[model samples]
Target: MTPHISRKTRVTGAALAAAGLLAAGITVGTAGASTTQTSAKSAMPIKLSASHRAELLRDASTTKAQTAKELGLGSQEQLVVKDVIKDADGTTHTRYERTFGGLPVLGGDLVVHTAKGGAIKSTTKASKHSIKVASTTAKIAPTAAAKSAQGTATKTLSAKGADAQTPKKVVWAASGKPVLAYDTIVKGVQKDGTPSRMHVITDANTGKKLFQYDEIHTGKGESQYSGSVELGTKKDGGKFTLTDDGRGGHKTTNLENSENGEGKPFSDDDDAWGTGKPDDPQTAAVDAAYGAGVTWDYYKTVHGREGIKGDGKGASSRVHYGDSYVNAFWDDSCFCMTYGDGEGNKKPLTALDVAAHEMSHGVTAATANLEYSGESGGLNEATSDIFGTSAEFFAKSEKDPGDYLIGEKIDINGDGSPLRYMDKPSKDGQSQDNWDSNTGGLDPHYSSGVANHFFYLLSEGSGPKEIGGVKYDSPTADGSKVEGIGRDKAEKIWFKALTEYMTSTTDYKGAREATVKAATDLYKAGSPEVKGVEAAWAGVAVK
Candidate 1:
């Protein structure tokens, strides 16, 4: 029985499997039990020396079924691609996940690249071993398994709790032999005042605890924010349910204590909203809704992105989370944003930037599906922060001006200090300003410093400066001062890199290349955007 901490995301291996192949906008068939075979005989090579192995990717077709058959995967195996990027050079990169016997394989993610004509080119796999398990049945009773999961979660949460979310069955594939398991979500608050939404995975057969990841994505920011803003809401029947049908039916709800019971939708007789006080439940809901609306408008206006999923469908936001809890998160499982009613219920983490930050997590999930660990995970967090700041600037809110400081308003550390400094990440004493061989070992939040620094320099340049009324002094790793290309150009280049050039497996180097390509496509090769991107990466020692 071991525990694992993960970024609060609903993208479990099983989630990817169930999501199926929606990346290419093509409805494809899934591989089933009839295809099972031992990896020894399977044609998919288990190991590769190159980032993109050419041998395994040259399948007859790039379909999910074809990828499995090409690799000689078992009939029970399935592949679900989350992203597809076709380069100008006629190379197509597909990032996908694998499921065996309908169970998610944790390390079974891969990137398949093909030539212009759609012929297989190369593959980059997260794991070298084949996904094979001996059994699928559970020897332990569901009742006993439930107890086992509850006990582990209670121990992990170390706080008063209530009914655990009903345990859902999933095949645990990231570790040992594939086995039937239960993923149970336990909600509570720690004695230290931290909200906990622990996800515990218990093996059904042996009753072994396979994995546990907490969903309490910690964050808090806001000062003087929330000027007058417009929102898109929908009408259900004669009453309004805070649903935004115009932007994919986006909705906002109240969780009261944010501990128990299903959320109650926010209803209002008039379109105007929020008193800006925590005592009023709709206050936080108002902030959340306004943030969602602004973020949606930001994407549509700036990048032409329809929504977080790029499907023109909206996502939801849940406000008034756990009592006195201090965090906010985006869960793909719920396809929504969850905010804690901060310390003393005075700080609702639903500030505009916070809302946009959490929402961008969904955007990243839909786009690159960046594995939330190591360098890749750092990029994921950085992506959210980048857009968080971008959305703030886009809103041009008088109360909350856009600055490079993250969580500047929330008092997350119990002080007036900001959570992070993009210009000088080490200001907080943990994040590394430069990328090192061991940078991957740091928390995604801290490892994100490298990219954050990159974006800051790319947008504003190095040394003492002021942007939107905030002061910053940025330094470079190689002692070479870089020039700025302005924030607008930086935002467009980064967004383009994320949407069209990067993949789930992209690292800092890959990000550099992606941004360069994006700059090239948007402003030509010699444009300042391209030069700024190149110098920015060098400033962080990524080159």
Candidate 2:
């Protein structure tokens, strides 16, 4: 008779599916019926994935293997081994051993098991414990097809049994929440899952459903930035609507197809997009929510600012804009945030720092209003960069780490280098660290160095130092000695000065004066804090 072993014990914890347990060298015998458990003729060879093997061995909380071996499997044939985990890009497949009691068996009626995270459940009675199969299906829904037809094609849907479009009228429910002319249009159930349609109310001539494209699924597919803002046109007195509905949920009644096709300005906050497409609307909503929350809180709590204009309201952050546009930007006119996906290594620029940088532009415009050229322009640009970097470090996220570099996480440059470096602005082919009349001729990115260097010196002080894993050794124009103030304190001083002292035409000297005023106000004029500010500017060679 073939020797059999029973390896069983109370293996408690989260259930884990015993995946792919195909072994080499041994075959199962015919179904053996008897009081005693079946055993391996020699030794049953079991193969397991490396990751699963490691987890089994590391699970010190249980004595499953030992208990199983003790039941029946003799030391000779009882094999308790480990495997090497391969590249775990995103999926996990593991293998585990199953025994009747605590012994190794050639073949026995054991149950298969499956669990999530950790913990085991009852095993399946299948003959095979694990089997190799094709890779898992994509976790995200399919992409939506973009509308390519040039002109707008009007197709009237049969309103039979369908909810007729509601006209613009103010309606209030018992709850006091104004149900303003809300109408729901059923597009039918989504192919992947869930129900979708249009819900909007506007004037008959307003042109709702003007532009409808396949709504991109949130989160999983490539990053798409579809942000809309209605800014005051030369004719409309700058009245613009800033709606960042990246998920394609906003539905309006009247929209015109402009020459730019999808580029037509979104008229209202609720605009319908992604012509009937299956997408993870939930994921997209969460992403947008978190992004806006982080950006808003960063500005308000950290800087004591109200909103984008310090008005206590919130700015818009659109997500899942297009198919795969891997980038984000802040439009000056629209004053909205846009995000895109990565082209190769480049990722969407939706991080906290980027949002802060963009928002700060509004702050600068309201206060210093530094021109986008010359020394003043460089100051304007660097102000955004410095504040952006500060805002990034301000946020502490395990998902995304804060660094002194801009666009580092986004990978805008396929080489993995950051978009810009404040510690050493000269690393880029064009940024300038010192003030030069000729510096104004360079692009804003390069010309931004003078102010970038100034802020660096003001915040960290000149000389060899390390703040957040980044190394720095800033120089000074005249071998003058300067002391550095910690970043936390310095940020406060600059923000205060920017909002309180500086004006639209504030220049390099004006920044110096404004900052000095801020420092003296925060710390007594002759206090150590004041001295540090002076020294920092001195180190940067700022007179």
Candidate 3:
């Protein structure tokens, strides 16, 4: 005779998330299996219907009883054994059991039963754990070539005291393949008698010297530069791009070997090349490096964080995502920032502000862990934009000036205008500087101004302020006058607040309180620092 008893324990998505975080799964029946059994005891296989599996996967709050009920199983039916089993007919059976004597239910366990004739007579638990399959991402970096004695294989160039070396570093590339790398930095002079510099090309693989070069200006006295280095692999193509601010203003340059075949323009559907001409791989490298370096420093210096996670590790940013995608985003799955070339006047979305904005998303994930949906969601988006702008200012990059505009250089509109206007929210058709129920309810990108304006007002008070030849006046609610806190302090306060006090549903008012609390914690309630938090919120009309 078979002893058949059903048992079940509820597992919610939150529980799963917690479990996953606390202890990763074990390797089960086969590698790459999604379902893993937990707990050990000789028990009957707790059979759950197909609907139960679907419900558990879809609903984060589902309980085992609810799942069982949905699957037409009795409430008392305990899930003693759950296994993804294949019968002789190749049909998958989800074996579950409800036992009168319940087995110990722990994570990563399987139930085994002895089948006497046609019924289960005895049951035992499998102590082995089942592991979850981790997704593998593809590595999409340009191939590196070997360094030769004369000039190319990836080798380091040694710098001598008070003297210069010939080829800083060189790598040979096949004639037809694409070569990609940035030019080495060189010293130069500005028209205004200021000193300028362009970073010498460093080997991407080994961080060694590849070549030396100088930045020059072109087209209406824009600071520019031209140079080349052996990036090593034609398999990825070769091109060098540079952003020079050493002189006075920003200069963007793209250099490619004329001999390398001309590449195609950007397209949206294409996943591999992203958007942009393949002509210059160096420019791509330059943009990627510059963005990563600036963001890495912003997190390190301002927040005292070692890196994104305070681990001193650098993340990758693919210059091109889709063809002419015209937007940049950070995907958690890939753990990377991807940019696209714009359709028209919008340049590539590789500006310092854009890069910082994308990178800040990673920081937000590491800290506040805010969900990207409602009021907290809007604050999250604004946090990125605000930090992005702050980073640009922090860098004082000659190529891209720090400003209130978000996609100024990209020229997305085909006109010389930016995508978002921070000072006067009304400049953009949708963005709102003032906070109200309606404003909070709008899209995060648009609703972002509540905090964005808050950041600007806090950094540079309400009223008129001109930067980099751009002019605007920020207004305040309650008409209380306040002074600018400057970006450095503002960033610190906001970061502290986000990582420490804010939650998923925190609103603009909540943000204000958090910042104030953060300020008090960092400086003091009556300190000048707290004054800025108060003033910043007042300027944004958050009250």
lDDT for each candidate structure = 0.69, 0.42, 0.46
Candidate 3 per-residue lDDT, tens place, 479-500, comes to: 7666775566577778767755
Off by over 4 Å in 1: 1-62, 67-77, 83-94, 111-212, 223-226, 236-238, 371-373, 413-415, 496-531
Best candidate per lDDT, number? 1
TM-score of candidate 1 against the unseen true structure? 0.72
How well is each residue in 1-543 modelled by candidate 2, as lDDT tens digits?
322211111111211110111111112132341211212111111223334445644652154456344434333322232111111121111223332223222122222122333333332111222211122222222111111111111132222222323222222111112122222233422332211232232212222222222111111112233332121111122322223232111211111211111233333222222211114232232233334444555555666454555434445555434444444444444444544433432333344455567667766654444545445566777777877767656555433445556656544456867677766678766677666667656766677777677666666666787654557677776666556555666776787666545543355666677687667655546655567777666655566
TM-score ranking, high to low: 1, 3, 2
TM-score of each: 0.72, 0.48, 0.50
For residue 166, model 3's alpha carbon misses the true position, in angstroms, by 60
- Where model 2 places Cα greater than 4 Å from the true spot, the runs are 1-288, 320-326, 344-346
- Ordered from best to worst lDDT, the candidate numbers read 1, 3, 2
lDDT of 1 by residue, 420-461 (tens): 889999998889899989887778899999999999988888
